[model samples]
Target: MAEPGRQEVVRRVRELLARYRDPAQVDGLGDDEPLAVLGIDSVTLITVAAELHQRWDVTIADDAVLDPEASVASLAAAAVAPGGAGDRPGGRLDVVGMGVVAPTGHGVPALWDGLLAERAHRLPMPYDAARGHRAGAVAGASAAEVVAPDRLLDLVCLAAGEALGGLDPGRRAGVTLVVGTTDTGGNALGHALAGAGDDQSALAGWVAERAAEKLGLGAAVTVGSASASGAVALGYARDLLLAGDAEEALVVGADTVSKSAFHGLAALRTLGVDGCQPFHEARRGIALSEAAAACLLRRPVPGDDAVLGRLAGYGASSFTTHMAAPESAGIELALRRALAAAALAPGDVSFVNAHGPGTKLGDVAEMRALADVFGDRVRTLPINSVKGLLWHCQGAAGVIESLACLLSLRHGTLTPTTAAEPVDPQWREFDIVTKPRELADARSAVSVSCGLGGVNTAVVWERA
Candidate 1:
C-alpha cells in the first residue's frame, strides 16, 4: 500500500475538523499552520486523531495530537507514517491507588472480601412510612448519618486518606480534589431545617471544598450528575490530567442515605422492600446505601509498580427524554463512545461491571443497550452488578462500582452478583455472573453507570 498524496491527506484532515468546528473555520485553515491557531481544544484534537485511525488505519502519537505546534500537515504526515498505535481521544490514566467505605466494609480489601463473600449489613429504613423496607446500610453508621455534616465529611476524609496514604506527603499539595455527590450539602440543609444548625449556603460544591481543605490538596471541583456523578468526576479529572491542568487528581465520591433521598425514591416507587437483587426475576428496586470511594489518578509513569489498573477511556451522555427512566440509545452512545475513545472493539471487552440498580425498567434499558453494543457476544461475556452487594450508593455508586472493576483487573476475577437467583429470562442473552469467575488472561473491562434523569457514563479499564 502507498501513502495518500499530501493534498489528499490535508483535505481529509480538514474534513474531519469540520465535524467538530465550524466548516468555515476549518476550510480557511492553512495546511502547515498549527491547528491550535484555529482554537481547536485538546479534546477535539484527540477526537480528530481517533477519527483518523478509524478512517485510515493509522494512529498519531498522543503527544503529537496534543502538541500546540502540530498542524494539518503534521497530522497528515503522521497518518501516512507507519508503525504506531493508540491515539485514542481521552488517552489513559493510571489508577495508582484506591479506597472505599461501603456497607460491606472499609478500605478496598475489606470491600473486596465482603463483595465476594456476599456479606452486607441490611436494616430497615428508619423513616415511619418506609414500612420496614430494608437497605444495605453501612454497619456502623447511623440512619441519620446523612443529616450529620461531620459524619459525611468523615467518610470523605477517611476514604481520601487511604487513597492518598501511598503518596509522599509533599506531593499532596500538587493533587487536585474532584468530589462527586448527589446530596452535596444536603446534610447541612437537613440540620438547618431541623433548627439544629445555623443557616448557610447548601451548595453542591461545598463538600469538595471542605474535603480539599482537610486533605491539604490543591484546587477542588465537584460533580453532581445523580448516580453517575463519580464516573463524571473521574472523567473530568482525566481531562484535567490530559490537558496538563493538574499533576494528579484525587477523585472522591461520597454519599449517605438521607431522608429526602429515601422518600424521593419511595415516592417514585423504586425502593426495594427486601434488598437489591439486580438481574433477578424477583428484583424489586434499588436498596439505597451509603458509601465513599477515592481513586488516585495521574499520567502513567514508566516503571511505576504501584499502578493497580489503567483508566483507558471514558464517555458520558444525557438523554432529555425522561427525568427518571433511562433511554437505551443514550446508554448505547456512551458505551460506543467509550470503546472508540479507548480504541477498543466491543469484543475486546472481557467482562462488564454494570449499573444494575434492580428496578425493572432500569435493568431492561441497560440490557437493551448492552445487547445492541455487544450483539451475540452478550451471551458469553461475563457481566455482573454490585448493587446486589453494595446496594445503590447514589452519587457514590459509580466510583465504588469502578473500584470493583479495578479489583477485577488486578485479581483477574469477576465478582459475583450476590444472591441474584432466578435470573430474568428477558435478559437471558447476557451472561450475568452469580459466582466468581477467572478472567483467563483478558486485560480489558468496562464499567457502565446510568443515573436518574437519563444520565449515562461508561469507563474502560485495563489491567496494569
Candidate 2:
C-alpha cells in the first residue's frame, strides 16, 4: 500500500491533538500554541498516538515529538519529519548501539564472527536473466528473502531491536531514527521496502517511520545520496546529536538486488561476473549484494560514557555528474573534511576501509584521494575493501563496512582483501592486507564511500 501522504499525516496529527485536549482549555486553543500550556501532558499525547496507531495501523514514537514546550503544529511536523539526523552544521557524535543484517548472519555477533573468520558470503544470482540481465553472476545473499515491505521491516527490526535492546524504550523514543539508501540499490535488501520506481524515493519516510515505530523510537528522517546514502546519513545523525535535537539516533543502511539496479549495472558494463577484486591489478568491477545494518549514535554522557565506538568525524562531497570517469576531488574533499572534524592528521589513521568497487576508475580514483589525504603515509597503512567479501551493497555499503571496521577495532583484527591479485608493481602504495593481521594499536580508523551521482563520503571511527 502507498504510504500516507504529507497532508494526511499532518491532518491526522492535528486532529489527534484536538481530540485529546481538555474541555476547560479548549476555549481558545490554537494549533500553534504549546499543547502543555493547554493542559496536555505526556500521557495525553501517548494516548492520542495510540488511538491513531490503532485506527490507522501507523505506529508512532509519540514521546519524541510531544515535548511540553512544542506546539501542536511542531508535534505534527515531528511526527512526519524528514532529513538526516545531523540537522546541525557542526559537531561530533558517538556510537552507542548497532545492528547487523548481512548474508553471513544477523546481529552484531554474526557480523563480528563472519568478518573475524574472514568468510565470504557471496552467492549465485537468484534473479533470472529477464530480471537481473545476467544469470550466473555473483551477488551477496542475506539469511532470508524479503517478499514485501513489511517483511523488510522484519529484518530491520532484527538489527535494530538488538542494538536498542539495552536502552529504555522511553529513552529510545526520544532519539531520532535515520534510514539511508541509494536511489535504486537497496530495493534488493530491506532498505526500500517501499514500492518500486517513483514511489521508492518518497517511501523512505514511510520506511523510516515504520522502523522507528518498531524500535519504539521518535523523530525520524530519510537520506538518499546513492551509494554514500548510509555514510551521509551517519554524518547527519552525528550532527543531530551535536545540535542537541536528540540524545541519540539509530541509522540503518540496507540494499538488495532489483531489476532496475541490476539493469543499471549491466548497462554500466562494469559489473563483474566472477568476484570483486577491489584494489587488485586484475580488478574487474563490483559484485552486487544485499544487507541491512544499523548504528546507535549519541553524545557522550558526562559521568558514564558507555559507548560501543566513537564516530569522531564525517564529511561528504559531491563532484556533480561525471560522464567519462569517476572523480577523485570529491573524495579528497570528504577525506579532508573528515580528518579536520576528527582533529587528527592523516598520519594518525591506524587503518583504512577503502571504497574499492573493483571498477578501474572507482578504485584508482579512491587511491588518488587516499594518497592526497595521507600523502606518503598512505603507502604504509593497512588498507582493504570488504566489497570483495560482502559485495557492493549500494547505499548500505558504508554502514556495513563501517560496522566491520568497528568489529576489527573490538577484536584487534584487520580483515583481508581478496588474495592480493597481481601487484600494481609501479604504484603498490597501498598495503592491502591479504590475510588477517592482529592490529595491536588500532586506535582510529576510516571508512570510505563513493556513490553514483558523484557522492563521496568519509567517516572516522575512534575506539573510546
Candidate 3:
C-alpha cells in the first residue's frame, strides 16, 4: 500500500531517529513512533532537519515535521512525494525601536551622537580603579544608580525600566523580554561571596522573572553563551513572531566585565595595552568593556520613525577548530549563508560592522575571509568596528554592534573605524572608511560576530 520510494524514506527516517535518540531510553523505534513520543525537542528537531538536508538534499517543512502526530513513516512519505513542499508559516518581521546602554553613551540618541561625532569613549576603568584595566565604560550614572545594590533581580528590573521608556502600557504588556548573557548575576554573587562568605544574589531565573514583571509581560526567556547569545536571542524572537507566539518581543543583551573574564583574557594576552583599534596595523588587542543593549521587535506599523531597518536574514555556524583562534572557513560560511538568505550579493551590502577584537591573528583572519568571499566588492564597501568606541562587551557586543548598524541606516552616515590610523597591509584591497562617510542610498548593512568555542554569526538588515 506504500508508494514506490516510501520504504527508502522510512529507512532514512529510522536512521535519523536512531542517531538522535538515546540508546538507553528507546531500545528500538518503529516507523509509526511519533517524534515527540521519542522525546525530541524543537531545537533537536531543527538539528534533525538540518542533518537530513545535508544527507539527502531534502528540506523538511517545520509545520509538517513539528506536528504532534508526525512520525517516521509520515515524514518519510512526505519526503518521498515529488511535489510536496515544506510550509514556512512565518510572516515578515521588523525592528521598531532599539535601546542601548553602551560605553560611548546611554540611550539611542546619545549613542548615535557619539558615533556620528567619531568620539572615542575608551578610558581607564571607572568602577575598580585598583584593577587598572582601561575600558570604554558607560557614561553618567552607575549600574547601582539604576539597579539596587546586591540584587540581580533589581538590575534586570532597572534595565527593563530604562529600555521600556515611553512604550504604551497595553503594548508593553504584550511584549516579551528575552535576555541574553553568559553570566547574569555571577559577578555580583562573586563579590558578595568574597565579602561576606555567603551566596545571596538572586539566581538568573528569578532575574528573568523580575524583568518580565517590571516590563508587564506574560513571559521571559534568557539566552546564554558568548558573542552569539545576542544574535541567538534575535533569532529566537524572529521565530516567536513567525510562530504567532508573541505580538512583540523585547530582546536585551547585557553583560558587565568581571574579574574572572578580565583576568582570563589578560592571561591569554588578548587584552590591549591601549584602547581597541580594530583592523589597524598598529592594533594591539581588545579592551574589555561593560554595557547592555536592548531592542524592540514588532509587526510593522505606520509612522514608526521610518524604521532604520528590518532584520532581513541571519545565519550561524559553530566550530571547534580553535579554542583561542579565529576560523576563516566558519566565518566565510556564516556570512555567505546570511547573504544568500537575504537574496543579496556582497555588492548590495553598503557597510559592515565587523567583530574585530583587534588581535593580530583575529583581524587578519577576518580580513582574509572578507577578501576571499567578496573579492572586488571588499574595496567598494565601507567597514568599521565599534569596539574602538564601546570596548568589547562580550555577550552584549553583538546587539550593540547591530544597534550601530541600525543607526548608520537611519542617519544615512557611516562611522569611521577609530584608531585605524594606518590600515593593515592584509586589508589593502578593502576600503577602510577612516572618517564618517555620508550614507547615500546605503539602505542595507551587515553585522558579523565570532566568539570563543568557534561560534560565528552574521545578520543582515535592510532599511524599512
Model 1 regions more than 4 Å off:
1-87, 144-146, 199-203
- Model 3 Cα lDDT, one tens digit per residue, 389-421: 777878777788898898888778888777777
lDDT at 364, model 1: 86
Q: In candidate 3, where is summed lDDT lowest over 10 consecutive residues?
A: 80-89
The C-alpha stretches of model 3 lying farther than 4 A from their native spots are 1-91, 120-123, 126-132, 141-159, 196-205, 301-308
Best candidate (score: TM-score): 1
* lDDT by candidate, in order shown: 0.81, 0.70, 0.71
Instruction: Tell me how far the alpha carbon of residue 339 in candidate 2 is from the true structure, in angstroms, after superposition.
Output: 0.5
Residue 77 local lDDT, model 2: 54
TM-score of 3: 0.76
Model 1 Cα lDDT, one tens digit per residue, 116-182: 8988876666663337776566657666663465656777888899999868888999999999888
Better candidate by TM-score, 2 or 3: 3
Question: Which ranking of candidates, highest lDDT first?
Answer: 1, 3, 2
- The 10-residue segment of model 2 with minimum total lDDT is 130-139
